[model samples]
Target: MRFRHPDGSIVHLAYCTNVHPAEDLDGVIAQLNGCSSLVRKELDVPVLGVGLWLANTLADRLANSSDALNRLKQALARNNLEVVTLNGFPYAGFHDRVVGKKVYLPDWTESARLDYTLDLVKVLADLLPDDASYGSISTLPLAWRVPWSRTRDAAARDAFNRLENRLAQVEATTGRRIRVAIEPEPGCVLEMIPQAAHWLTPYSGRSLIGLCLDTCHLAVQFEQPVDAFAVLARAGVEVVKSQVSAALQIADPSDPAARELLAEFAEPKFLHQTREYGGPGVDDLDLVGELSGHASWRVHFHVPVHAAPRPPLTSTTDVLDESLRHLVGGAHPLTHHLESETYTWSVLPSAPKNQQELAEGIAGELAWLRGRLVGLGLEEIK
Candidate 1:
C-alpha cells in the first residue's frame, strides 16, 4: 500500500504489527509467515506495508547478530511485506498477563530506552527498501504524569539530546533519514496536543524529532481532530505519521446501559486509559470502576475502525475521517505515512474468532482508509 497524493509525494498505508505480539526474533519471523503473509494475501496485492513492532529483546538480538538480521529481512521479502514505520512504544512484555505501567517504565528518561530506540533505528535502516529515503518510529512520551521531578526532566532532556545526535550520525553514515516521533497517550506527561507542541518547542528547528499523531488518543482527550492538527501545524511540529484508529465513545457515562457496555471491554491484558468530560476533563487508567459523568466519555481502547461495538457504545471513526480530511484534503498532503493501529483485537469482546476473520478485519480497516484517501484526490500507486 502506497498511495500518491495530489502533489505526487508517496503516502504509505500500513497496519501496525503490535496487534500480534511477538516476544523474540523467532516469533517475529513466524508472524511474517503466519499473520502478515495472510493479511497481504487477503488484500490480494503484490505488496503490503507493515508498521513492524520489534520488542526490546528482539531488537537487542538483531542489533548484535547480522546473521539473524539478514534472516529477518529475507522473511519479510518472502512474505511481500515492507517496513516503512515502526511502533517502538512498547519496551518489553507487551503480551504479558498485565502490562499496566510497565509499558512506560523505561520511558524517555532512561538510557536503556535510548539504546533500544537506537537499535531499532539501525534495524529499520537495514529493513528499509533501497529506494525508500526515510523511516519513522513512534515512541512513548517523556514519562507518566506522577513522579514528575526535576531530576527526571533533566534525564529526559539529556536522553533526547543524545538521541538527536545519534539520528544525525545514522543519516550521515547510512544515507537514510530516520525520525523518532513521541506519541502522547491519555495519562502520560505529554498527553494532549498542546503539551506535545510545548515539548517540541525547543527543538523547533529539528526535523528528526516530531509528533506521532494517533487519532484515537486525540479523540480520547476531547480535542477536535481538525483542531489537534491545527495546533501541531501552528507549532511547526511535523507529523511523522498519523495512526488511523478509533476509540470507544460513550455519550453519557452515568447511564447504566453504557456502563455495562464499557465493562465488557475492560480486561487485564492492557491498560485501558479512560477519559470523561463533565465540566472539565477526567482521566482514568482503566475502566474497572463506575464511570459516572454527564458529559461524553472516551476510552483508550482501540476499536476496529470499520466497525462499531454493540448498542449504547460507538466508536470515534468520524474523528479519524476528519483528521484524514485535514491531512490530505488540501493540494499538499500533511504526512507521508498512515498506519492503522488497532492492537486491541485480541482483547476486544467482538474480536474475530478465527485467523481468517482477523486477517479480513485488518484488511478491511486499510481498505476503508484507502477509499477515504482516494476520495480526497489521492490514488493507490500500486
Candidate 2:
C-alpha cells in the first residue's frame, strides 16, 4: 500500500514478510505467489508494497547473480507485490524455536554484519519500484548492552562509517539511495530514543544511517512518541522507517490470570523484555519475576496493531497511535516508510491454525492500519 504525504512525497505502507518462515529463495517465491497474493487481493489494492525479508544466503545469491535477482523481481511483479524496504534485523535462523539472543549475533561491531547489509542493499536497489524515492533497512541496535567495550563501540562506529561510504557507492552505481535504520530494543547497547539520538548525533551529516522507531519497543520503554520524535529531530536523526506495531500490556501483573498469560507468551522462541509502566524494566521475560507486581507492565512482544489481547490485558496501541499521529498525521512527513511488523503470530496465545488463517490475520492488521493512516489524512493509492 502507498500513501501520498501532504508534502507530495509517497509514503509506503508495507507488512514485513519476516513473519513467514521462508529462508530459501524457493520458499520466498512460493510466499509471493501464495500468501502475498492473497494479502494484495484481500486489501483490494492494485499494488501492494512489501517489506521483504531475505535470508543471508538468498541475499548473496541475488546480489551475486543478476539472473536470480531478475527471477525474484519477476515473481513479485507477477504477484502484484512491490518492495520499498527490507527488514535486516534477523540475519538468519529467525524462525528457530529458540531465537532469544541469537537474533543479536554478528552485530554491527563485526564485519559479517556489514557484509550482510551490503548484500541487502544490492538486492533492494533492483527490487525497489522505479517510482519509489528510496529504500530502508532496519537493523539491530549495535549489540547486546553487556560484553561490549570501548573497543567494540569503536568498531561499531567504524563499521557504520564504512557502511555509509559503501551505501553512497551503491547509490552511484544503482541510482537508488538505500538508508539503514538502527533499531534500538530494550537492554541493547543503545536502547532509548534519547540514547539513540545521542549516538546518532555525529552522523547528522550522513544521510544513510538513521533510526527505525518500533512502536512496540518505544512503548515498552515508556517513551512518549511525541517526545521521542522531538529528540530525534533535535539530534538531526532521520527516521528512515517505523515498524508500526503494538506491544502486550499487563494492566496489573498481580492478577493471577495475567501472570499466567505471561508464561504462555514466554515460549523459548523469542525474547520478551518486560517493563513496568513507568518504573524499572527487565531485559528478558526470564527476569520478569524481578519486576514489581504493583503496576502495569509492557512486554516487548509485537502484538497486532489493530487488536488488543483479551479484556484487562490491553495493548500499547494507544502508544502506537501517538507515534502515528506524528509520523503520518503531521503537516509534513518525517518518515516515508511504515511497516506492520508483528512477527509474533505463531507464538501468540491464540496462534493461527493454518496458513490461510495466518494470511487473514495479517490482512486484518494491514486493513486496520490502513484505516488509521487514511484517517490521518494520508491518501491511499489504489
Candidate 3:
C-alpha cells in the first residue's frame, strides 16, 4: 500500500470525500473502500485517507455535547476512514468584505468570529484519529476588512494572533501538530507569492503553519507553478496540501459582444449595464446578485463542464504533471496529502453515463503524477 520512490520518499494518494452528498457518508465510505481495493489490486497502492470538508459542521451536528468529540472518533473508526483535513473556514463567521454591500453585512463580529474558528479547530484536533495528520486548515485573509497599504493593520495583526493562539492550543491538546496551511487565493488578502511570504514571515520558524498552494489560485494570479513552489520553499513554509484546478482570464464569455464591450465594461458605463441587464446573457439571478456584489466576479470565471469551453484551461492531467515535476523534483517530496479536486464534474454539461468517467479522471491524474515522479528519478514504491 506504500508508494515509495527512489529518493527515499513515499507518496500516498488520498482524495477529498466531498464527492458524495453529506447524507451519503456511509455510501461514500463504502465507495472509498472499493476504490482503495481497486487501487491496491490494480495499481498496487492504497489510498492514504479521506479528506472531509464538513468537519466543523459535522462535528457540531453529530456531536453536540462534551462527548461529541468522542462520538466523532467512534464514527470515523466505525467507518474505517480517517480525517485527512478540513478544507475551508468559509462559515467560520467571517464577513465577505471583498463583495460587501449594505445587504451583505459582516457575518460575525471580530471576537465572535475568532471564537468560532478556534472552537472548530479544537473540535477537529480532538476528533481526528490518532494516526491522522492535519491537512490544510485555511486562513482566509481576504475575508478581513483592512486597508491594503498597511500590512500590519490592527485587523490583520489580531487575525494572525488569533490563528497562532488556536494553532498552539490544538498542538497542546492533540499532542499531534496540525498543519495550518495558508492558501494564497486570488482576490483574497494574501493573493500572491510575495504577499504569502510576507504574511508567513511574522511567524518565522513556525512548523505548524505553512502554505496550501492551489495551482488554480496561482494560475489566476498569473504566477508560474515552479516559481510559486520556490517562493514557498524560500519562505520555509511547507506546502501542506494543494487543490488543483484551472483559471480563465478573459472577457466574460457570456457577453455576446464581448469584443466590443470589453472597453465599455472597463469604463464606468459597464457598471450601469451590469446593474440594468445584469451584464448581458447572465440568466441566473442569484449569480447576477453575486456579480453585482463583487466586481471581480466578471474577471475570472470557473467554467463548469457544462459551461462554454475556453483556451488555456489546464486539465486535471496537466495540473498533476506540472505539480509533480516542480514539487517532487525540487526535493520537496510528496509529504502532504493530494486531492483530485475536479468538483466541476457535477457541473459538467452532462453527467457521464456512469461513475466510471469520474473515477477514470481521478485515476488518470494519479497515474500521470506517478509517471512524472518516476521520470524525475524518484523510485516507485512497489
Candidate 4:
C-alpha cells in the first residue's frame, strides 16, 4: 500500500517477506503465490508493497539471469505485489533455528559483503516499478562490536565508496535511485541512532548511503522516536527506510508471569538483545538476567504492533506511534518506506497456528499501521 504524506511525498507501506523464510528463487515464488498473495487478499487492496528478503543464491540467480528476474517481476505483477525496498541484513540462513552473531559474518569489511550487496542493488533497481523513482536496501551496521577495530574501518569505507559509485551507475542506467541504509542493532559496531549518525557524519557519499531506522532497535535503546530522527537529521544521514516494528517490553521484569512469558520469547532462532533502562545492553535475552529486575526492559524481539502480549508484558507500540506521527509531520519527509517487519512470527508468543493465521497476522499488522497513518493525516493513495 502507498500513502501521500501531507508534505506530498509518497510513503510506501509494506510487510517484509522475511517472515516466510524462503531460501531460493522457487521458494520465493511460492511465498508470493502462497503467503504474500494471501496477505494481499486479506487486506483486500488492489496493490500491496512487499519488502522482499531475497536469499544469497536467489540474489545471484536474479542478478545474473534476466530470465529469472523476469519471472520474479511477472510473479509480483500476478500477485498484485510491488517491491520498492528489500531487507538485505540477513545474508542467508535467516530462518535457521540458531541464527546468532553469524548473521553479521560477511560484514562490510569483507569483499563478499560488498559483492552480495551489489547484487541486491542491481536486482532492486530492476525490480522497482517503472513509476517508482527510488529503491532502498537495509544492511548490517558495519559488523559486530567485538571483532571490529579502527583499522578495519578503512576496508568498510573503501567498500562503501565503491558501492556509491556503482549506485550512481545503476541510477544513471535505470533512472531509479537506489540507496543502502545501514540498520543498527544492539552489540553491532553502530549500536543506535547517535552512533550511526556520528559514523555517517563524516562520509561524503551522503545521498547513496543512509540509515534504516528499525523501531525495535530504537525502543531497545530507549531512544524516543522524535529525538532519534533528530540525531540522524543532524548528521545529514537520510532515513531511507523505517521498519515499523515494536519490541517486547516488560515494565516489571520481576513479575514471575512476565518472566515466564519472556522465557517463551527467548527462543533459540534469533538473537534477542535486551537492555535495562539507562543501563547496560545484553546481546541476548538470557543476558538480561544480569541486569536489575527493577528497571524496565526492552527486548530486540519484534512483536506484533497491533496487539500487546499477555497482560503485564507489553510492546513498544508507543514508539511506533510517535515515529509515524513524526514521519508525517509535514515539515519534510524523513523516509520514503515503512515496512511492518515482524519477522519472528513463527516464534511469537501468540504466533499463528497455521498458514491462514500467519497471513492474518501480517495483514493485521499492516491494517493496524494503515489506520494509524491515516489518523496522522496521510492520505491513502488508493
List all candidate RMSDs to the true structure. Answer: 1.5, 1.1, 7.9, 1.2
Comparison by lDDT, 1 against 2, better one: 2
lDDT of each: 0.86, 0.90, 0.49, 0.89
Q: What lDDT does model 2 reach? A: 0.90
Tens-digit lDDT track for model 2 on 1-382? 9888777889999999998999988899999899889888888899888899988889889999998888898999999999989999999999998898899988988888999999999889888888888999999999989899989999999999898998999889889999999998998999999999998888885778899999999999988988998899888999999999999899889999888777777777998888997689887777888888888899899988776788668899999888999987887888999999999999998999988888888999999998898888889887
Best by the lDDT measure? 2
Clashes of each: 0, 1, 8, 0
Tens digits of per-residue lDDT, candidate 3, 1-382, equal 2345455555544555444344223443455555433433344453334555543344355434665456555555654445656654444212122222211122123454455456556656765556554545554544433334453345656765777777887678667566666667544457677788777776757767667666655555555677776776677777666654443333343444542333322321001112211332131223343343322222222222122343322222344357666765655564455554443344343444555655555455556555555687766544
Candidates, ranked, TM-score: 2, 4, 1, 3
Each candidate structure's TM-score, on Cα atoms with residue i matched to residue i, is 0.96, 0.98, 0.66, 0.97
lDDT of 1 by residue, 1-382 (tens): 9888878788889999998878787888988898788889988888899999998888988988999999999999999999999999998888888887888978877889999999999999888887775899999988888889888888898998899899999999989899989998888999999999988866765889998999999888888977787888788998888898999998877788988888888888887788777444444435335545767888888999888788799999888889998877888877788899999898898778977888989998888888898898898976
Candidate 2 is scored at a TM of 0.98
Off by over 4 Å in 3: 5-12, 21-45, 61-80, 92-113, 126-135, 144-153, 248-320, 332-335, 352-360, 374-382
lDDT of 4 by residue, 172-241 (tens): 8878899999998988999888999988776524588888988899999999887887787678888888
Total backbone clashes of candidate 1, pairs 3 or more residues apart or in separate chains:
0
Q: Which ten residues in a row have the lowest lDDT in candidate 1?
A: 279-288
